[model samples]
Target: MPLSEYEQRVLEQMERQLSSDDPKLVNTFQGRASHGLRRWVLVSLGALVGLTVLVLGAATSNPLVGVLGFVVMFVSVVFAFSPPRRGGPTGVVGADGEVRRSSPPARPPRSSGLLQRMEERWDRRRDERGR
Candidate 1:
């Protein structure tokens, strides 16, 4: 549903008035990027808590539990460092202070024998020639 020009102008005027009337609210809406950040932070904290529990269990005469805790901690650390699917660092602050990166372009469900096929077939022919 596209807005008509009149509706757009009215909405813009309303937004301008509201922003002037309540700058704080406008800033909160535009500047906040905490949803994804909060999720990642909570997951990291959960992993840390679980590791602590395993460590306590290990101290209580379960050596296997201790090993599991160590492994979990390692995995958690790796997860913390792992980049997002967009190839940018997760939990990282960019120039705009947001915790997200430019996302990768999504591949189409059906490739139309475009770039990928050319690359793959080029390598296949090279490999066949080498053999």
Candidate 2:
């Protein structure tokens, strides 16, 4: 089922918070989040060129040509699968279908919270056990 508008708003708010809190994770997951069509075109072109070269090499029975084609294919495939370059504005598309630009927080978080929370829980358990 489609999310209600309220839920969408909540999700967008959470996304905004996450993006601000951990830009690294946001960047990692969302990539540059722009120029997707261009990226796809480049990948397809690279793969096509690589495949053509491979076929030409096979037809000629040339070891050097074959090796070159193999290298090209390998590199192109790697580039295709690699994450987009980290540049440009970061954005997250909300369920409402609006793109929200999110800038990184001015300062890095002192702690990610999970570790500190776990430590607090551990301390509480230890104290409880002692008592």
Candidate 3:
């Protein structure tokens, strides 16, 4: 649910105080990644641990342990399956640092012998008729 106006005011007040008290902590929280390689590696490691636990749980015939292992494995696998982060945008960056997309030429290039021959013939016929 959305925060009430009073609660929002309180939260904003707290945020201001926190920022004033420790700006570095706020920066750290804001800069934390949504996704990246380090995250994938950590999740993979967790998955491995989960697999080990799953095996152990099976050996011990413990339902709770097995369920925990399965849950961890499922979450890790889903998290790890996210698309790789892009290096940068596909567009070229101009000197001004703005991304500029390169467009294809107005006329597409083609080298069909049949088309060339047909054009040549049409031109010759037009010239003959003009004469």
Best lDDT goes to which candidate? 2
Q: Residues 18-107, candidate 2, lDDT per residue (tens digit)?
A: 755665676576544457778877878888888888889999998788788878878878988887677745665555545568664468
Candidate 1 clashing pairs, residues 3+ apart or interchain: none
Give the range where candidate 3 is weakest over 10 consecutive residues by summed lDDT: 88-97
Instruction: By lDDT, rank the candidates, best first.
Output: 2, 3, 1
- Please write out the lDDT profile of model 1 over residues 68-120, one tens digit for every residue: 77777777677767753332343323333444433454676875768988997
Task: Please list the C-alpha lDDT of all candidates, in the order they appear.
Answer: 0.66, 0.75, 0.71
TM-score of each: 0.35, 0.51, 0.38
After TM-score superposition, what is the CA distance of residue 21 in candidate 1 from its true location, in Å? 38
- Each candidate's root-mean-square deviation in Å? 15.4, 6.9, 19.5
Q: Tell me the lDDT of candidate 1.
A: 0.66
Q: Give lDDT: candidate 1, residue 92.
A: 26
Best by TM-score: 2
- Which tens-of-lDDT digit does each residue in 22-104 have in candidate 3? 54445455443764658878898989988988888999999889888988898898878865444443333333445445453
Model 3 scores a TM of: 0.38
Ranking by TM-score: 2, 3, 1
